[model samples]
Target: MGTITTFQTTRRIVMGAGAIAKLGEEVRRLGGKRVMVVTDPGLAGTGLVDKVEDLLKRERIAFARFSDVEADPSYETAVRASEKVKEFKANVILGLGGGSAQDVAKVSSILATNTGGVSTMFGIDLVPKPGLKLILIPTTAGTGSEVTPIAILSDHHEKLKKGIVSQYLFPSVALLDPELTLGLPPSITVATGMDALIHAVEAYTSVNATPMTDMLAMQAITLVHGSIRTAFANGGDIEARSKMMEGSMLAGMAFANAGVTAVHAFAYPIGAEYHIPHGVANSIMLVPVMEFNMLGNIPKFANLAGMLGENVAGLSAREAALKAVEALRQLSKDLQVPARLSAFGVKDADIPGLAQGVMKVTRLLANNPRLLRLEDAERIYRCVL
Candidate 1:
């Protein structure tokens, strides 16, 4: 028998339609009076920001809005946001957009409370205290940033993406309202759904997997496999959107506790270097990385195949694993996700540098079922290229 540790989800998750409407009530319940609403420019103009403000106004909760977040939010931006938190004297922070906005909000909250630059807190569990109370509302059904205890910020000057992982970073509340995702563009739908798929797959195959994590990861995989295409094909498909949102949140919970493996380790460098959206980068690398990792744990792959709706009965574990990779590849191709790094503007000559970056992501690489060294990472990058 293997040792299985209990998994932890620190956030109180409130989901379903009209969940956003309860944002004010949830904040009040948390005893927050002054709050800062963090969001990106696109969502700021979409009236979503106003809707949240209206809810707060009706509840008589004092709030300020900060809509300066950008895609691949940078360290400088986080610092700027932290200043806003201080200036507004916000007692709570509301993250209201996709991953970038959520990440910026989390980092800003940390910086506002902790006395240091954002760079000082990079890596796991470095923050000594919980920051401001945070309520995360994810408008996109991807990234799973709402529930994860990690936040990623880009360092443009360093040409790298760094993360801060701390249980303290977990939102006090995660408000998931699928209605907020209906207006997401089709391209974003495909990219983010693929990201959710990668999160579940990587978590399931992670060496640190526990029974609790496995259940969440498997359910997440099944949900994404069943509904991603429908959501991508029809943005207004509330049912599909709801499922994807749930899957994304579940994946975040699973991976935050159990960790992620090589796909994410590889995906991060691509995102940092190419400025590719995080989800798109994950989609591009997922199939190839999964194929590479399949030999490490055949039974896990077989189970994944079954979860992805492959008929694995009577098939050898190896065969079933291959089927899982094939299904993922087919899904990516069907959704128009870029198949190779080359498609995202990577040159063959750049594989060595990317491989080095992948190897440097030991936090994630350590969780891979199969140990990944520079040579293997290079080979995988070349294959994907």
Candidate 2:
């Protein structure tokens, strides 16, 4: 037996086309009278927020919109958002859009109730109480923020991305509408899909992997591997979009329990300092991190090769592991995601500091299959720089 483990995710997840239609009803079911709708500025302008407003209006739910959420949002942004929740006197916190918006919503939910600095809530299971009733609607088929009981915020002062891991961070309800993902640009689609894929990849290879998490992760990988290209090329395909969303959610559940490994740890520093998009940052670090990680668990890496649909017939586990890395490289190339840190303007001089940042993400690094040192981190950063 591995070890005693407990798995948790959002208790109620509503998935299908028009899942967003349940937004108002869900809020009402949660006994919410006044609602605070949180989303990013870009999504605010996209008429999706307008649809959300219309739903609440139809239900006669009193609501306010806070659309200032940004990509890799700062802790201050979350503080500001919580203040909005307070100002609105909202009984329900409705998080809309993708990861950033959802993460901000989670933070806002907790910060409203916790009555403490957001920084204090960072790290594992530190929040002492649940926040407002929360509902999450994911417009993009990535982040899995709706399901995962973790919210990440950027700490600009430290130039690092920090995560808040608390059961209270999980939304009371999650609404996944595949149609909401149709309007995503190809770039956004590809990046988010890769993020979803990497979540499963890392979870499958994590030292913390449990049997249930492994089941979730393997299925998530297969779903994403089959659906990502179709979704990327034809963003309007509902079937593809649905599968992508499902894959992302499954990946979220997998990583939520088993935890993601070094790829996320590596991505955070670049993402925080360089302002690389989260998915793109993960993509940039994926190959190098996996190449380094494969040595620790060649059998898992070999499994990844088969799951990613690489023909691993008649190959040794080590050889199949290399093929897994090759497959990720080819997929990144095909999807046109950044494959190197240099593309994000990360310089040779920045490697050491960035590696140092990676070390601070000990929560994630603890799950890494391979034990990594500071020098190893620096070398990994240099690999793509």
Candidate 3:
């Protein structure tokens, strides 16, 4: 048996169709009076921001809004948002929208309490103190930023995506309300759903996988497999949206504790360099990374294949693993996710640079079941390219 280590999740999660309504109560429970709501301009116009603001107002909670967060949020954007948090002297932060907003809010919380640039916190356990009272509400069924302790922010000057990993980064409360995801565009739905799948697949096959993480990852895989198509086809499908939310949350919890693997490590540089959406980058790299990692953990892949509804019964573990990769490839094709990095304008010469960047993502690379050398990372990039 693998050595069992203690696992910890700092966030208290409340999940349901209308969990967003509980935001005021949760904030008050944490003794937060002044709050900042961080989100994107698009969501701010959708009136979802107003709905949340109303909740706080009814509870007599004082708040401010920072709606400049963009997709694939940058370090500068986070720093700018942190300025608002500091100016308002906000005691609590409410992240409302997709992963971008949630990530920015988490970073702002840290910057509000800590005295340093955001870049200083990149890497493992670098933040010295716990972040402020943070409440995250994910409007998209992807990225799982609500429950995760890791946040990815782009560094435009460096042309790379940097991550901050620390137990202190987890939110004080994660409120997942599936109703908030009802109107997502089909394209966004497909990309984010696939991102959730990548998280489950990587966490399940991670070198650090524990029994607890395994259970959550496997269940998340099943939910994504069964509901992704329905959610993509009809964005208003409440039932499908609910399942995706649950799956994404579970995957986030599992990966946050067990760690992500090569897929995420490889995808980061792509997102940072090419301006690819985080979910789309993960979608493009998912199948290729799975193909590379299959040999390292055939049994896990076989189980994943079975979870995705592939007919792997009575097959050898190796064959089942191969089937799983093929199944994921087909799913991506059906969802209209680009099959290759070349499709996204990645050049042959960029492979070497990307490989170097992938090597720097040691926090994620260390969790991969298969050891990935620079050459292996380059090969994987070429395959996807």
Evaluated with lDDT, which candidate comes out highest? 2
Screening candidate 1 with a backbone cut-off below 3 angstroms (N, C-alpha, C), the clashing residue pairs are none
Error of 3 at 262 (Å): 0.6
lDDT score for residue 362 of model 2: 90
Write candidate 2's Cα lDDT for 1-385 as tens digits.
Answer: 8467898999999999988878877888999899999999999998889988999999999999999999999999999999999998999999999999999999999988986688788889899999988999998877888999999999899998889999999999999989899999999999899999999999999998999999999999999989999999988889999999999999999999999999999999999998999998998899999999999999999989999889999999999999999999899999988767787788898888988999998999999999999999999998888
lDDT of 1 at 194: 86
User: In model 2, how large is the Cα lDDT of residue 210?
Assistant: 91
Worst 10-residue lDDT window for candidate 2 reads 337-346
TM-score of each: 0.97, 0.98, 0.97
**Structure candidate 3, residue pairs in collision:** none
Off by over 4 Å in 1: 1-4
Clashes of 1: 0
Per-residue lDDT for 234-346 in model 1, tens only?
98999999999999999988898889898888888888889989888888778878888999999999888889888988999999999999999889888988777887799
> In model 2, which regions exceed 4 Å deviation?
none
lDDT of 3 by residue, 150-215 (tens): 888998888888889888788999999999999899899998999998898888999999999999
For TM-score, the strongest prediction is 2
Ranking by TM-score: 2, 1, 3
Count backbone clashes in candidate 2.
0
